[model samples]
Target: MSKEDPKTNSGYERTLTNAHIQLIALGGTIGTGLFLGVGNSIHQAGPSVILIYIIVGIFLYFLMRALGELVLSDLHKHTYIEFIEKYLGKNIGFITGYLYWISWISLGMAEMTALGIYFQYWFPHLPTWVPGLITIVILLFINLLSARLFGNLEFSFAIIKIVTIIAFVFLIAYLLVTGGKTSFGPVGFGNLAKNGGFFATGANGFLGGFQMVIFSFVGVELIGLTAAEAQNPKVTIRKAINELPLRIILFYVMAILAILLVIPWNKIATTSSPFVQALGATGIRNAGSIINFVVISAAVSSTNSFLYSAGRLIFSVTYDGKGKWNETFGHLHRQLPQNGLILSACLMGLAPLVIILIGNQAFNFISSTSTSMFLIIWCLMILTHLSYRKQTPANKLTDFQMPQYPWLDYLTLAFFGLMIILLLSLPANRMAMISAILIFIILWAVSKIWHQERAI
Candidate 1:
């Protein structure tokens, strides 16, 4: 209905509908994390990983509902970045926006690096940099187009992911029904606990799985970003966020359950894609290769979404009058943040180069930091909701409201707090958590210095 940026004169049209927002959120949440990272998570936590997904999914549901309420409370506002500045302070808003931008850039790098690794599965001699660079270039080209183009690409990617998961599940179901056997053994649901109990990995191992589990859901909140582009924020975001629980169950919970039914948890390969390994184990022809193709598609879709969001997020933050870089990065060209998109693409491309130069460990380290930073961002979203509730009177008008207000908000915060503590318990995430804190402190200090000078 509207075709103008809420805070700027630039006429950015709201062309996205409910379907675009729904599928984009699906594509964002179901990325390399489910396809690649879950293999390692299963190796660490055994069948209990299902519980981890459910737990995180539930908390995020509440978080998204809270965000939905905030967005719909004022249909004219495009993004929560501005809400932070309006309700909180300019400094918090500035820091949160930039941190989110940085997180997506890091995530884009991780997805691209995964793309290269997936490619190498076929051609052992192909350098990792080749696919990563090619992918970055391809996604950059796509993301530089109109916002509708980005939404359409995401919808296509979501379709590919849905088809692959359904195929995997049905294939496994058929094998189980027909009493199929492979080198591993007979297909049956007993595989879930056959190797060891559900918590076979012990309490520490189960807790350790939360880091990867939470990381897998990194892009779940991307739906909030899409609110600005929706044809109707109140209707579109509500429908999208309301369906999150079912989407999580279908995509994460049941899909993993299918994999476990076909093969023992311990038998699943930690280093390779578990879906590929499980199918190949069941004597499916070219199963691993076929699944690798799907994974490649998933990685590409994810990187494309992240690059698109990163650019828009930067534009959203800087376009506000108080932003430090408002002069040049403040506006859009041709209804798109062309300059911001180019800048983010260049920075994102560098991550793949780092992977090429430093090896897989670099990818792992940066990816961990990205996850940790995103966790902080999630916490901030909940905190912002808390602030919104506090500042607004009970009688304030809201087209959509998060059910079980204050309590749900409080529980969401507690869940995130526990996740941070669990994150610190693992050596893999400790450094990344430390790095996130350091970045925040540095940003706060710099923002304070700049503010005082401007005031003087």
Candidate 2:
């Protein structure tokens, strides 16, 4: 295996290119959140959900830019956790690493549960756990193959999702231009306001929708994770982050816009994908089946990214000697983090089976939990970046700089803080927010005790 950045020596190899990095980032952000969760957003926010996406996207762009600058400052750093340890203290580093891992694990579990739901579309009589178990085993084998294989699989998955979105956009455009009618209604921009105005559900509904909308963008920052494996850390990461805005607009905003244009917001089903609901509304033959396959592909893509992220996160922390299992957990097999990979898979895979047994409520529970966790992780990254900037010498030059440095960073932090508070306003999200606070307290206590023991 070939190494990408040679500044630091680690067991892992860097075999990923810019294409893989871009697609992996895309695959992470675009999967189950948009495909499965969007229906629920539309159900709650009405057409006003579009604004929610834009708001979240703008703030996330700032977060990624800040992350890009931090990564470029030190190519030797493979994971953001290393940077956190340096800038914020060992205690924070430990807490952030564990929280980040937990967030991805929650996210992977959500995707796996979604996989089972999509599978049931074809085999309505089959148990959800059966498919969930099979997918977990298959993904474990694929991830264990090599780092490049995981990239390739995610690349394929991202392409399928992008193609599906593009196809939907063009199809909806054609229908609107031709003034076509579907089983649901006529296709046009009018469908947005026709239901009960754009803010059909009112301000409360729009505010409530943020819980789900925020989750859709959970994995967007995973681009930072690829810095270690990227062929050219600075160049590949810069290019990938630069292209994110276009992707957000195309894959998320435009796709959702197309769906609403074809199907009125009130008429969209909460239990099914809005894309599928819109596609099936066209009265096209076998459209439901086609979209079902696309959604299944989306779910699989999410799970792949989730597993990859969780493994790398665990390996990075342990490899750096931050955790007690440094030797055992950090040891590699053929340049891969086999121990971490298997451990992450085994633990995360159980979530789907449990969710299946618990029934529908588990879906919301996992989604909300991951959403709250990821929000805090993003905030931590921003804070780390701020500290890094403050400590830099006046004459120092960075290859990649976060534009509009101090003000934008502050603004982004403020927004994330507000979102956390707003999360409490919603009944569905309140528990997840409380759980996140409790988990952080627990991790902080654990890290402090462990440090005292190690010092003794």
* Top candidate (lDDT): 2
Q: What is the TM-score of candidate 1?
A: 0.95
Residue 355, candidate 2: Cα error in Å is: 1.6
Clashes of each: 0, 0
lDDT of 2 by residue, 28-71 (tens): 77888899899999999999999999989999999999999988
Which window of ten consecutive residues has the lowest lDDT sum in model 1?
1-10
Measured by TM-score, how close is model 2 to the native structure? 0.96
Q: How displaced is residue 439 in candidate 2, in Å?
A: 0.7
Q: Residues 209-273, candidate 1: write the lDDT tens digits.
A: 88777878988878888877777666777888888998899889989998888778887765567
Name the top TM-score candidate: 2
Q: After superposition, how far is residue 373 of candidate 1 from its true place, in Å?
A: 0.7
Off by over 4 Å in 1: 1-10, 322-324, 356-358
Instruction: Output the lDDT of residue 52, model 2.
Output: 93
